[model samples]
Target: MLYPPLHHWLLGAVGEGRLNWLMLLLAAPVQFGPGLRFYRTGWAALRHRSPDMNTLVMLGTSAAFAYSLAVTLAPQLFPAGSRHVYFEASAVVITLILLGKLFEAIAKGRSSEAMRTLLQLQPATARVQRGAQVQEVPVDAVRLGDLVLVRSGERLPVDGEVVEGRSYVDESMLSGESVPVLKESGANVTGGTVNGTGAFTFRATGVGADMALSRIIRMVEDAQSSRPPIQGLADRVVADFVPLVLAIALVTFLAWLLVGGEAALTNALIHAVAVLIIACPCAMGLATPVSIMVGSGRAAQMGVLFRSGAALEELGEAQVVALDKTGTVTQGQPEVTDVFVDRGWSVVDGEQHLLRLAAAAEASSEHPLARAIERAAAPSPITRQPPSRRSLATAFAPSWTATRLRSARRGSWRG
Candidate 1:
């Protein structure tokens, strides 16, 4: 039978004069089965010199059991059969508390799985270039200065600096920005970002657990383990509340025996037991877990992932806001602002010359300034050698060449 039904049977027997060894034997499993873990965990916490809500429940339930056992076995020790035992009430309270804990465990397990999904995005293997040979190896085996190859549609496996070639990198996984970023030599690439439309070689700067994705995972994990202030308050209340309730119950029992006489003793004991069973901190214990589940699930749907209950709580209280200057506040894309020329420079001739110079200098660059130069020179038709054939002398002809070289860089632009 279920705990509630069995508890009713045991309670009825105890209320009448039929308390027996068989009833106690049957009730023992019902009391201890669901609650055994709480006792074990509470004992372990105490052994380790820590106290928790489990400790309060353990002490309260143990007190109830000991008192009821004394009353059941030896009624004369408690002013004849006038006063009553509430072993069933104690058992029911423990069962309810255990049920709450089971629900909490299930909720926490799902949250942990959400974090696991984030961790799984990190690629295990990376294509590394050693001298002139390229080989696929475990990402952890990659070291600093190793050249890692990333291709179109593949996730970058380590934080690195682009050393050869160019590609548009989709960094939405880390920055939440939708547009692809063009990366070339000296540009920083992060692990878990997708490469777009081009092949590139990058020098590894971070590997294994030191990668950007791993640090994000670590931040989430740390948030999950940290407790919020509300949880701390609930824990403090539970710690002292259980013992205070037990003391009240004791006083109630004594007051009934002394002031209200023997006839009122049974009624008074019943009231005390009822208070103990109803005031069990089950609802309070469940409060934080339920809020966390609902809040985290809502955040996931909105593309915001919280690493822990503490993070959720802190986010709710946050007032001062800091935004990344480039993407969060202003559009990261730059637009042409003005065109200025040296004194006595012809408007038409100077414009054409500046455009040519800008296009050539920025032909191999992937910076926002380079892209702006390319866009400004798009309408003009200009033929230039491929990036590989172009000498380094032509590529680094000062920042002014970007404006003049803009037209040549336009044809190769994909963004």
Candidate 2:
């Protein structure tokens, strides 16, 4: 492909004089542009007390440039035209190295879509209940203890407890569950989950960077920033390999000049530059970043977000998996299977009367228990009352009579 055969094309270009002037003209810009990034990165790694692939590519390409420059300007310094220029080899190596870097960047950009998706989940504004008045305001302007009112079809804008109403919340964005979970007063809700069925007012306990969704996003960003362990090996090899190859090439040229004369010296110098160009270490530098990008993108599709290269690497060796009980092990739903009351609290008439009162209290609510109550009371005669100030208050009051009145208002009361 474009990679494994790069060295052969480089060698061929040098053997033909097609690349000489072109190589000299393009060398500085290519070296300073794409090549310089590696050079600087390697230098930073070294200063940080670490070595990396850039260190090797930089040293090797620099050697090739110096040697080719020497042969180009002063042909007689080595032997009678014995020092041949391998300008094409240097140019081709730098070009291929840059291509590999571009590929790595493209791959990483693709993997970062997970972060973009997470950012898109945030709601821009929230309806806050300031006493009896509700106002739409910027989400960032919201604070802890603020009572945020979420209407049907609106996204919950902060992590908080449902304080004033009941609703079914679509929590798939945060929990990965497909069902709409019913939430009520004292139930916890997260920012970005969609409110379903009814309006609700929740106390804003978490906002800004402290929200659950924001924390998950931060974790993924941190994961993307972390370096994998295998990159260290490639770095060490590149660092030592570059200068060592240059020294060997120099020795090869001197040995050829002393033992085999002018013709052999020319061949040796060309081969020496070939060695530096062929061993540029671009592939080594590309290996880790490309794999990390591919792995992270695939993980996102699977709904398993990886926050770092180290986390993904660690998962590869994991022997056991831990799952949260609420959403993972059990269905996050409540069903009213049965109900009983103490003799003193029981209706004087019998079981049907108590059932009618309990079902009535929950009829107008969108809670899971309300749905179950409505379903269970289906056989009874029910009537829907007009919504009025008295009816709304009677629906939410704590007394049994009020409960019966609310159920009657919702048409769940049995005559």
Candidate 3:
């Protein structure tokens, strides 16, 4: 950090007191601008009878600034030859603290950016039907009971009930359905859904923040803002440590003054200020939370999440292991490769029977297993296309009817 020539230049400037005054000018803004913000916030906290880390920060930086100011203005008032300025100390400390806060704000923003991005996905405008006249207006202007028109290729601006026409709308955000949903008269559609190949007019039931997408965004924001059930030990320590730290700072100043009588007053004062600055406790306070946030974020990216700090601690202590098939032993996306039938069931045409039954039951569902069974029931071995629900119902109806007839015949003979 030391440049040889710059160091020599500083030594000369110190003797002449030129560089010292320049440092004072540099320290002024650091103390009064960003650093003064701490004082304002900390003072507000004190007025409400609740002081925190900000209070400690303000006291530390203030002590350093006051000492540096005294040293700069009156060199003769000090213990002769001990009149050194601490402008650099106070300035660097405050600036670094502010920089840390800037980075923390950015981190928090990124943590909840998903909500903002979702909010932005809704269309900006809507075609509203006010009696006979249809006009394009801002989505915000669309109100409850207003009829909003959506075309073949458009995003719905608000949650509404379809009043006229019919179309397929993609509602992946709400239902996680890959296929577009058919929306006819009386069908409900949500905001942010993409319209498929048809035109429709719907009555707005939920506009503005009342829409499903808006509620989802708010939900995500709240989840990110809520604290976990069990907080880290460090957070509890910091909560109780504030009052103790302030008391220690007062004791430090008085103890130094008593130890170094009158001749060492300047030395005593400088030592006291140094103690306060060193005892700011920012690193101790930030260490646990920062590490947890970063670690949790990384885990979430990998598709894993801990419910709380307590959960993470329990995970660290795990020695014995039992793999549950439902959650812990998944390949993430399940597939239907095999089927099991009970021993009492007839198996003469097991393959065909199972395929028909599965396809028939799953025909109305959009789940992957349903699609897989429907594909397996296709007549052609190479056909990859899924059968329609109507076709599946037609195909399975005859086989099921014959099985019921045979069962009835056996029951009549027994009776």
Candidate 4:
């Protein structure tokens, strides 16, 4: 097609004197075919007295094509020394522009994939119970107050309150918390959260467009569509840039022709064409997209993810960053220095069970405090039926008390 093959052929055909006929053939298809899009847009801009990068590109390529065609057809009009054709210059510029836009599209797609990954977090289907009969249904079919059964390790498809059973839910995707939050009867649960090793039944409180996940997706889309503050400056520059470039090109043409003697006409046209090509709106127009793309790419590499292109742009202006003290600035090498248990728990002597539960709870945490708890509980050597480690410390820090924290942080205990 005009995309992949056009660039390859044009690049290789550059400076090939013997293939002028083939170059002419290839160049004709480009200027008349894909190049027509630029001409139409450029001509419209000209008619309206508003030129753009398209105008610059169109004028440059057109001049190159016309000059080369004239040289090819009427060799007698020019001396043998001035008989140079630039079919490659015109074709290659368009091909390069196409190539740049293609790469830009691919980059933007990748940048926006964070939202796709988030959307995929919601389960495609849910086990819903209506009276005595339970049936599998698409997540969209789930309605408010419906009894949705979330199995161990399954994702909850709707925001709801737990009606029966107990489980730990992983809300990392939604809130960036590395630990799973515990859920029991009367506790509210969110959609897109991963159920821990325990199954649970919850009455759906929010469904369809009202769900937390749906809201998140909508916010991300809105952010993506929103323009950054700097976009105003870029727009203003683009508004006047084309006309200014045209003036410069005209001055360059006149200057060369008026100053040079014998080869002034040919020299003037070359300077004017050079001005047009050099001033192509590519870089100026790309200021915003390129910055956003580059910012996204660089941030992603550093384990930082942005919600959208607009967010990335706005982040550049942020003078302060908030981070967790236990892990962000320090070595995060917390050690469980003291263990405090409640009086009732002490009377029962539940240290063995305590250690097992503690070990399982803190394993999923990236923070140093959780690591300390995990380390202290690892030596307990007790086992239970939870199947694997849990992220309870980082998970329950917001709601669970110190006693509950110690109980879950000591060992791999389960009921």
Number of the top TM-score candidate: 4
Model 1 has an lDDT value of: 0.70
Give candidate 3 misplaced runs (Cα > 4 Å). 1-9, 12-17, 47-49, 76-84, 108-116, 127-138, 147-153, 162-169, 175-187, 195-202, 219-243, 261-264, 284-415
Q: Evaluate model 3: give its TM-score.
A: 0.63
CA deviation > 4 Å runs, candidate 1: 1-26, 40-52, 63-88, 263-275, 314-415
What Cα-based lDDT does every candidate model obtain?
Answer: 0.70, 0.70, 0.70, 0.72
lDDT of 2 by residue, 1-415 (tens): 2475774686686652445455677776776766678678767876775555666566667767877777666656666444555555555666766665666566556556877888778899998878788889999999999999888889888899988888889897877564588888999999989888887889999999999989988887776666777665665665676557768878877776677654775667666666666777766655666676677667767756765666777778889998754554444554556666545443354455555656666666666666667666667644433244464344334465666687899889632
lDDT of 3 by residue, 1-415 (tens): 1577885777776763666677889888988988888899877876776766667678777887788778777767887667777777777777666665665454455555555667777998999999899999999999899989998889999999999998777766566545467899999999998887689999999988898898777765665555543334544554566667667766777777788777556666777777778877667545445655676566655534343445554665689876533424444333556767555555566576667766766666544455667777765242334455555445455455566577688885211
lDDT of 1 by residue, 234-264 (tens): 8777656766776888887777667766466
Query: What is the Cα-based TM-score of model 4?
Result: 0.69
Candidate 4 residue 128 Cα shift, in angstroms, is 1.5
Assess candidate 3 and give its lDDT. Answer: 0.70
Off by over 4 Å in 2: 1-19, 39-51, 76-84, 239-275, 301-304, 314-415
Please report how far candidate 2 places residue 131 from its true position, in Å: 3.0
The TM-score between candidate 1 and the true structure equals 0.66
Query: Which ranges in model 4 have alpha carbons more than 4 Å from their true place?
Result: 1-19, 79-81, 220-235, 255-267, 282-294, 297-305, 314-320, 324-375, 378-415
In order of TM-score, best first, we have 4, 2, 1, 3
* Prediction 2 TM-score vs. true: 0.67
Candidate 1 vs 2: which has more lDDT: 2
